[model samples]
Target: MAAVTETLPGAPTTGTGEGERRGRDRFHRGALRWVLLVVSAIVALLMIAPFVIMLLNTFKSPDDYSAHGPLSWPHEFYTHGLKVFWDRVDFPVKLWNSIWTSGLVAIFGVALSLLSAFAIGIGRVRGRLWIVGVFLLANMLPQEVLIYPLFRMMQDIGLNNSGWSIVLIFTVIQAAFGTYLLSSVLGTFPRALLEAASLDGANRWQILWRVVFPVVRPTLSVLLIFFFIWTWNEFFIPLVMLTTNDTQTVPIALASLQGDRMLDVPTLNAGTLVSLIPTLIFFLFFQRTLTRGITAGAVK
Candidate 1:
């Protein structure tokens, strides 16, 4: 009788409630997705708008550029501004100085950071936590606070007005973050393998270079890119340390174009457009290696 009642056509079906719930859930999810898409698109447009304006203004005639209506599109395009900017700026020397300095910062900064992190993370040294905490504290301090003292020290050592002074300064400042990051990486990997390397007649330095370094290469690549960008964009330290026309970096050279009044709108944009290209090219070239390193860390 119970079986016959359960099989009756008039009985309530459990699937009805489930189907209604699923319909509500699907509607909510669809609405949320659309909301996120709209927000993301708006943010992306805002970020890209400045660059678009810069590029458009680069081709505008100097007469068309006015303070009253700067954002308006030009009736005629001109190449004269770029030519003037290049002729005045000395692009080749500034570009070469920037390239080698940034490269040195990335390479030396990462190497120092790795060694510091290895000591703190792998060597199990006493007070490692305190040392790392100090580095973290130092990193948080503004560059402005440190620059004056650094300048004075450079003067004392007769290192002022030299390119090497700024390079060394950047390396030291950039290494702080690298040390913290690599330390985290060091803590995650197993130490037994490192121990085995040590026992197999490998010295501490050999184990670091031969064993631990290979494991952290991907993370190192990411750090290298970061150091390059940071050093390239730096202005204050370089301005203080590098005093001569012969030693100035790209930023200093561009800043030189600005006067007490009347900044060159079109030509300034053209110069900026020039300065940003190398950074763009660098990131594009190393994009894959960076992606893999970041993902590898996330997966682990």
Candidate 2:
């Protein structure tokens, strides 16, 4: 009979094959990470190139722009384009209207969405899933399809040609979205927290305002950023609703710079650049919240 052999405890079993496999895996991961980083950097540069060119054009003279090209760097930076566009567009009124309209949309729309989410997510009412399904359906419908009906409704309510008309339109459209995002966060909210609050004598509304709102403020900030940017850049709603120059938002005013009689590239570029600045600044401030807010609703 062959001699019996025993393997000892706490002994490292070495294998060249296993070691090679692990080394290969590490190599593959490192290569993939570097590849993705390079790809992302290329895409970022591509997106930034247009804005950089637009910025360069903002300072160049119209005569130089025509002689040279949009891609050409400015020989001398000047404020002529900025001043000309600002004066021509009646920017003060447009800026004011934009601030109020977008602000109203972000504030009121987010509030309504939060309350609705609280009822559906935290309240745990009957048919909550059905309610969520309806909201999802509404969100899926194209804004274009709803625009005509909304326009008619605004007309009937005598809000046509008013800034509130645009405000209301943005609120209605964005509220569905805010509800969707907030509900995802609230749905997963700890029931124990709500119960504890109730045990502490807090009412439902108080629980929502005190407990829920504080927890979901990150998501709320993300939603506010989204609403503000969309409203700021919104053209179709304002175009259909706002009749006169006085009621027009910054986007509409910037668009007015594009005339059929004469194409003022420098002024138009300057206006475009100006319109983008607020949004860029806003994102720079709130960008950290963006990643967290988007993922906070999802699982760990």
Candidate 3:
């Protein structure tokens, strides 16, 4: 046999060029990731800066706020500003009124809408289209149009200038849109489930309580938070409905505090800060529900 020419038949060589190309690609990708991270961090900080400014300024004196930059640390932390704002704004009463009015509005609004949506959105309902169209039309009406009629009705019912008046208006305004929203959510639910419940001798009320209510809890939580925030911040309705300090909500009270002449900047800022507390607390409680609801609603 001819002596086999010892040729290394295959020394598998990693091509230097290909290896260099992959290394370059990985380097670029890593650099891009770092760039993105830095950009996101910067954006987050920018968004948080305004809140930091507000919180710090709440504790600052008028002179300190004016003398130093908004980002500056206060030389003295004082509750004087907060105390002044509380005394001037009658925060306790206003806050209590806001909480009461908002809670009633949310409760009535959600309950009414949930009932309406179920009645109309379920397959058993006849004339669903007409009812939905009517709701849509009502939703489209300008809130200003209802003002006169509502005002007259309130006067007739002895609800004028009372917390109940505000609560009633909020409920009315919220019901139409709330119905639309919940109907959309209900549309996403499987119809087979309803049929199954009906076949199992579950009454409409039982289906609503056991099957529908659980699935809609997240949506309800989101709506409650939104209604609370909107009612808390509502100025126009409260302005028209209520004329007395005793019944006024926080926004009205805050606006009244910042009258044309007596400009107490520190006190105004402090009250503004205080006004945000309830909303912040509300968000803290419902944020997870809100996020999940939005995600689930969108997908369904």
Q: In candidate 3, how many Å is residue 54 off?
A: 2.2
Q: List model 3 lDDT by residue over 1-300, tens digit each.
A: 787745366976658989999999999999999999999999999998877877888888888878996678888986798998788778899999999999999989889889988887764478777777888899899768888989899999999999999998888778888888888678667888988999999998999999999988878877877787877888887898999988988998889767776666667778889998888998888788889988875665
The models' CA-based lDDT, in order, is 0.87, 0.87, 0.85
lDDT per residue, candidate 1, 156-176, as tens digits? Answer: 988889877878888988899
Better model by TM-score: candidate 1 vs candidate 3: 1
All candidates: CA RMSD in angstroms?
3.5, 5.3, 4.2
Candidate 3 weakest ten by summed lDDT? 5-14
Judge candidate 1 against the unseen true structure and give its global Cα lDDT, from 0 to 1. 0.87
Q: Across residues 1-300, which tens digit of lDDT does each residue of candidate 2 receive?
A: 999977689987669789999999999999999999999999999999998999999999998899899988898887899999888888888888998999899998899899989988887889988888888898898768988999899989999899999888889779988887778778989999999999999998899889988888877877888998888988877888898988999999987888789988999989998888877887888788887877774433
Instruction: Quote the RMSD, in angstroms, for model 3.
Output: 4.2
Give the candidate number with the greatest TM-score: 1
